[model samples]
Target: MGFFTDCSRALLTILSLTPASNRHFSQHPLALQDITIEPEKASPGFKCQYPSLKGWTNCNGPNSRDCWLKDSASAQPLFSQYDIHTDYESVFPQGIHREYWLNVTDKVISPDGYLKTEGKVVNGSYPGPLIEACWGDDITIHVTNYLKTNGSTIHWHGLRQLHTNEADGVNGVTQCPIAFGDTFDYKFKALQYGHSWYHSHYSLQYPDGVAGPLLIHGPSSANWDEDWTPILISDWSHRSAFQDFYVELGNSTSGVLGREPTMQSIVLNGTGSYTCDPSTDKNCLPQNKRKPIFSKVFQQGKRYLLRLINASTESAFVFTIDNHVLEVISTDLVPIHPFKTESIHIGIGQRYSVIVEAKPSAPVQKDGNYWIRTVVSDGCGTINQSKPEIGVIRYNAGSTALPTSTNHTGLSTLCADEPPENLVPVVPWPVDHQAVNDVLNDTFEAFVSNNVTHGALRWDLTDTPLWLNFSNPTILNLGNTTWNPEYAIIQESYDRGYVYIVITTQAIRKDPSKNTHSVAAHPIHLHGHDFVILAQSNQTYDVSATPKTFNFNNPPRRDVALLPAGNTGGYLAIGFKPDNPGVWLLHCHIAWHASSGLAMQILERQSEILPTIPSLDPTRKTCKGWDKWLAGHVLDQDDSGV
Candidate 1:
């Protein structure tokens, strides 16, 4: 069968298998057993009753401002007999299809009142246009690269690309980069729901500006009066990331070690204020010519849902609003039990869905303006001209005054995630302890080494630092028995059982130079699955004792988590079922670290992948185009090629 034909067949099968009675939840609206079947839905199907503001019998539907479709108070399933506990890996609603077209090009832009000569953006905007969809919707995105010299690919951050590995979009691991002027169509099912981002996976591309917000609307654990667009908070650099990479790599000729690039300012949803002296810098815009301050209007007593994403090149932030309490609803793509906090520590590539009640502290100003702060976490990274108060929240819609509210006191500056105990998943997933011994026996040590990749300093999560060939991705060579060592492949053949992997910053290997020790936290992200955090600790991993500390009982589960920084010991242990049969990239979300080889590929059930994929013609065609473009071009592959 042809590729699209297979996808169509799968969708049809899903529709046919769904009991007609359950389509509208005609009976047993909250009963989980009523939806039982030999096999569950995995593909697109006929348009079913999606969550909407109108016509839902029991409660407000998914699109309602006051409540999410099947909220905690409704007692109704999220969609057609499915609730929070339903195994999302196997079942999803038969949602409609969503299509989008993005044109990537080079342009001169000023996101922070300073012009960037080498900016790359999608559809001519930084933090590109929002891509929204309903849960279980089949999405098709056509990305055409118009860069004068570079190839590009967009990775759907935090989306579990189940059964659709080809659409995962890691340039060298999934498919070759989309050659200049060539369009690559990415097709995948919305297996998981929540807000995330889509960014260029090609080296240094996303940092330049090729990224945008992606929202897959679904059920929520908390109710809100309004839903806001995703707030993308990032550390910005005046220079293009490509040029800054040279400083990060350092001068090998002079024996100077590479240093982390310093960011100039913080941008919230693509706008920030930078102090520039026009006398010294002609690229800096005058105060009158600069963009206005980023602000959001809030009504008194109304609760609002806010989606926050950290898309920084190398910084973690503490998100907060002065004088207002935050109710965190979800972490990453997983809905969690609501918890109240003064501030949230967010790592790179991490996302949070929080609800903020519009009640200000006593003696509210007549203008009622509050500051939205994205404070860079100390020790995690640094910014040259750091500004925590990058935005404003106004209770009065017409208020143009700056906030006079004082920041909440006692906010920690520690560079770490919210305590693991606080991030309780609403849907409990009890991890099996059978693999405890296996995980302890094969723990992956993450450390920095200067010996790898021609003496350039590199970070390694495995024995070897990852290096990729753009012309040869792992998907194209799935049938091979032994893979290239530089690919950093970890094979897992289990199709039904859970696979637990422990990653630590403590150096396990003996380094004669003693330069392998690094006290930097890494935001480790795994594609294709939302893994359970079995254990996260700042202490050294004791093989025999640490196993006892594992939280097998429904620990915090997400796509990304911070591996704490420590010179001697700090570790993050995660477990996931290897049910998906494809190659998935697991790497640090830090742009510089990833390019420096802190990455690896997981070949899960490789033997089962080729037989499922009907054709590689689409993959081959893009590679051919890339090869053709490269024949006449002289672009050097300097970084890890993503």
Candidate 2:
């Protein structure tokens, strides 16, 4: 943790985000103030009907639901209320069972002593409810917004909604927000099977603690005799300028996400110690002691499916359960070949499922006793803020707690003991004079085209000319912005060194001719890859008009570098070797923009046996009316047929 310290404060872009800051929370409509929500036991789902807009319905039960606005309101506005029941289920949430709600008020505290709150919340729980399902299950959820003035839309992060496009709730793109005093249904089948998550899609509620774990269990036919538990980790902070996160991330020895910002504390299975002292969180004390219900236990020689979700609005941590070797199976709703590792790297809004086999016996019989230790570090493999907390994997707790020993420890026998790589590329060095000079006289150009940022990535999605556009054209030529004409402008800002080959400028910089300037630089940090920094100029990077060669060797492998604010474009080359499967986040380091819609997930293709998301029940066809409309839009794809 001490190592995260050397950075130029002036150029440090704020990359750390929390659940409450207005930037991520976005303001929830216009309510006078947040009215407190007092928890009371009530039948789970809403029983009454509310008027529907855009033909939206509330058929979705507590399990799954969609919502829309009610003519957008304002006032001392009497807010509505919803109730939910949570239990100690397994990592996998059963079919049609989840909690969702609009968090009216209350603040979220961070390990670094920051408190954050505001906005609608799913399942009424921070990090939301842990959803578990087997392959091929019909998941239905109905959400009711009790907030006075806000509206929101929730999205199942990483779930493939095959023919379900509207259900692919991405605000302003898929559908509209679930307005105040209204409810909608979110019905979909779990098609692919792997660890996934859910969060508000319409507004900034996503980063505002409105996300949770979604785990899909593998087919029962697989080999293994063990139980699984989901450990969802979040770096929470309300709105403390003192703990503004960016300071911890940038100033730390590691650049941005590359370093372990000082988290208030790492949460295990949603709870830590009872003393409320995160710094001295000792998870070993028995339930009789404090935070008793938070205990995690496992028998030796058994494979425990660990569903790991990085729910942090910012910091990512490397979780390591002492003395246990984890056989990682999947990440972000997809799987890599089964690989063993001492710990797994969990990034913000990412998930990893691994099977950890407990050792039957201690490795060394010291004083006829042994201690099991669990620890974690920065998920990006940079700097760590906290020391590893140790806990014993107690065998036969009540009975003769024989001095633990690894006499027959089966960890090495049950799984490969090799560790998994962090996979995020470590920058070799900052760009020095030699590296910069290498690109002084080289350039190349390619054809450029445009593609719609559709909700469904690989299907019936389209714009017009399907050909790939490679040239860096004026922002307006990209079709990214459909913005109002009054605010748009043009300028020729400059970045001393950098270039951006923007793919969607037509939608952003809407005007091509007037020497327009309303452009923002995206400090896109490459994961597991490094690119060469080229020259930067005003306007944009015109590959067709300028030079185009890249330098990969001896390149700066930094974790974070700005693309220079106001520059229309910049260029660099990311090197990916396909070491890990599953999608990784590529977007503006700015948390607000990133939360809004400025992000893309790139799947690192691999041949390893990967996990699939649980499929939705074939029997359920939404409602009778909604069925025909959806069937008409069902996408068809395949090489042999359509």
- Global lDDT of each candidate: 0.80, 0.36
Per-candidate TM equals 0.89, 0.46
The per-prediction tally of clashing pairs is: 1, 82
The list of candidate 2 runs beyond 4 A from truth reads: 1-121, 220-222, 238-263, 273-290, 360-393, 398-593, 596-642
lDDT of 2 at 625: 23
Q: Which candidate is the best by lDDT?
A: 1
Ten residues in a row with the worst lDDT in model 1? 33-42
TM-score computed on alpha carbons, candidate 1: 0.89
lDDT of 1: 0.80
lDDT of 1 by residue, 1-642 (tens): 001223533564565333222332111122322211110111234222343213323233433322323323333234323445545565555455567899999999888999999999999999998887766666889999999889999999989876678889998899998898899988777767779999999998998999999987666777776778787999999898988887777776665668899989999999999998877999999888888999989888888888999999999999999888899989999989889999999999999999999998766766789899988998877798888999999877888898887788999978898998899988778688877236754577776665636557677777678889898889999979998888999988886667989888875443526446777888999998899998887788777798788898889999999988765689998899887788999999889989988899999989877754546778888899999999999977667777
- Please list the Cα RMSD from the true structure of every candidate, rounded to 1 decimal place: 7.0, 21.2
Instruction: Give the clash total for candidate 1.
Output: 1
